[model samples]
Target chain A: MEELGPLFVHPYQPDQFWILILIVSLPAIVASLYVLIRGQLPAALSSSLMILLPLVAYLLGDIHLMDESKRVNYCGSCHEAMSPMFETMHNDDSTLAGFHYKRGAISHQTACYSCHSGYGLSGDMTAKLAGMRHMLQTALGSEDYPLRLRRSFDIDSCLDCHAEAKPFRAIEDHRELDIQEALLARDMGCTGECHETAHPEEARHGAAAFAEAR
Target chain B: MARFAALLILVSQLLLLRIVFDTTGPPSTWFTFVGHPLVAAGAVLGIWALTRRLIREAHEHKMAEREDH
Candidate 1:
């Protein structure tokens, strides 16, 4: 398969959009119509079916929504401001996000959500809300240039996936006593000290070039 | 209103599918414009409906009690 491109920048069209629509809509439309045409179901059954059918529809719809959100194109197209970051991810070079994604440490699909998503109760909701804020900021042109994150990336966010992996722990310096302490302390240097950051060299250079050109 | 709000939720979600998954559309569009607004609108409508339902239920109970008296 061709490498996934940014959501909106595809040279060719994909059918996933329609597939999503069909998956979500077909069952719903069918179920609603069935209930409408077959009026006067038993009261108990009517109430149950009314709730159940919509729940089923929601369940299926959400599953497809989750699946589609995993696509790189889906996220990149959502905000033009984020497009540069997507470009950085897609380019080949060993950088923090790019390298891990390319190395398969992160999912090829859902890369954006995987790292950014919160891990505990309401984690997904929190992440999504934060994402919404970013989107809104981007849309309103209120976001700062280069788009600083609210805070530095959390060490826990990295450790969530890496904390258990033998290879992750086995990295040479990461195994050092002080280094381990720092990692636990959520030291910013812990990650960059050994493993690279997610951006590729090309991306870095591209940023530099843009700056120089300016 | 509940029904309308519920429909909005479905509509918004469907619009999001196009925004998120449809690559054939023009590249310049932020499909979220369609999807996100729908979500907000749906939330507002749903809340309005729920409150209305509660008020109606309370009123119905009051009337029923008055009839008994």
Candidate 2:
């Protein structure tokens, strides 16, 4: 059998798994609505109740499974969020992203959730309020904000986990380079000198050829 | 007619909430399930309650007119 990618291989959390079940139950919800519209209140209510009971039960189970320290409620109980920074990280082929998610990097255990959602009650409350504002905007039909990738991209989030790992060495090295002198000498550190582009300009120019094979 | 009106109001409210909570992607599964039904029911109940109040007020107006006559 062919090896599946990390995205497919990893088991989702219990809450996520239950959510999949809820998604599958959408057809039942629709069926109940049909019954209700037909003036069959008893049947409609019964079917709705049947679907609702399991949902409530599953919610309770999820609550129990969630960490008390990081109450799922504080993650804005009503809000839905998947930060764009995370999307960029997922899109990148670098080991930095994969290591953090794939359990290869010990520093980033419970990685994405921990940094974005600060620790303790006060942090949770702050996040909830921010979420509320976002919710309000969405409700008002004012959700057409341009993708402000910069605001979402926080180097600090990476530092929070990897500070001890000396990830800053790369930045320090970059700062040491005299870019002006290098450029004047026609010997840019980036090309034809030291740091070769991971995806070189030549390869980028013929990207279509590579893309077709993929 | 009343129920249908209620249902429409409820749906809009739920959609509003969904738009708020999930700006990046579609509303989370939990939000879709919880918010949709709750808003719908709440809208229906609210409209029904409002209609009842209007009927009561109209009946009182008729009663007052009779007393005056």
Candidate 3:
């Protein structure tokens, strides 16, 4: 028997599941309502069936959509998004992006929303709003926007969930540098080890190489 | 036509999933293929074919009605 992995993981919650269930059942509910209002059983049944097919499709779609690990929503939906960032990743003459993407290292499973978004409502809202703003800017022809990289990667954000499995107790040296100092230096910022590349320069060189090869 | 559209959606979803979930293995084969221009060409052709077929069917149905009149 194939052992299923952990049932509940990050981003998947009881409320979300219930909301999904409601969404999946909406067609049927709407069909029923229509039938009741019109007193037309046969029409209602047909309408219900019509709704049923799409509902199944919706469920399937929801399953795929809800997957936090996929870059479908992140990269595909907003192809123009952080274009420079993706260019840098895929352009690695050394095939760093290709290598990571292939190995699934440079995807939703590891980067973007993972470290940036904290868990629960507050995190989700912040990430989504920020994404919306980015999308708006991208659409409005504001190409000179700054990148999303924080001066210093909030190691605590990474540590929040990962601390239990991989305890990251700050050493004495780690404590020496304050948050402002870390940001200015760009030390301990995101990387392939965290969320792919921390700097645009690294991405550009890597992307140039990757594009040349392909 | 709807079926073809649904299939396209499904395939797109799969590709998106490959982008998102990293299910295509340690070194994502799907990304390489999806990122290729060939896939885009194929998708465009498929959509064009499906749309043309649908329009042809609609035209034929209208012609049949005219003949009946």
Output the number of the DockQ-best candidate. Answer: 1
Q: Give the per-residue lDDT digits (tens) of candidate 3, residues A34-129.
A: 433543234225423333433353445335433432343344333443444555445443453444444454343445565556556687676656
Clashing pairs in 1: A7-A73, A95-A197, A95-A198, A95-A199, A96-A197, A96-A198, A96-A199, A97-A198
- Please write out the lDDT profile of model 2 over residues A111-148, one tens digit for every residue: 44454444456655654455545555544545433322
Give me the runs in candidate 1 sitting further than 4 Å from their true place: A2-67, A120-122, A187-189, A192-195, A200-214, B1-69
How do the predictions measure up, each by TM-score? 0.55, 0.37, 0.37
The candidate maximizing lDDT is 1
Best candidate according to TM-score:
1
Interface-residue RMSD per candidate? Answer: 6.5, 9.2, 12.9
Docking class of 2: incorrect
Name the TM-score of candidate 2. Answer: 0.37
What's model 3's lDDT at A111?
A: 57
Query: What DockQ does each candidate score versus the true complex, computed on alpha carbons?
Result: 0.11, 0.10, 0.03
Ranking under lDDT, best-scoring first? 1, 3, 2
Docking class of 3: incorrect
Note the Cα lDDT for every prediction shown: 0.56, 0.41, 0.44
lDDT of 3 by residue, B22-67 (tens): 3222113333333223234434544454456567878999999999
Tens-digit lDDT track of model 1 for B12-39:
5455445444532232124445544555
lDDT of 1 by residue, A54-167 (tens): 344444444555445546666676444555567667775356777767776776667887877757647677775775576566566666554445655666667787789898
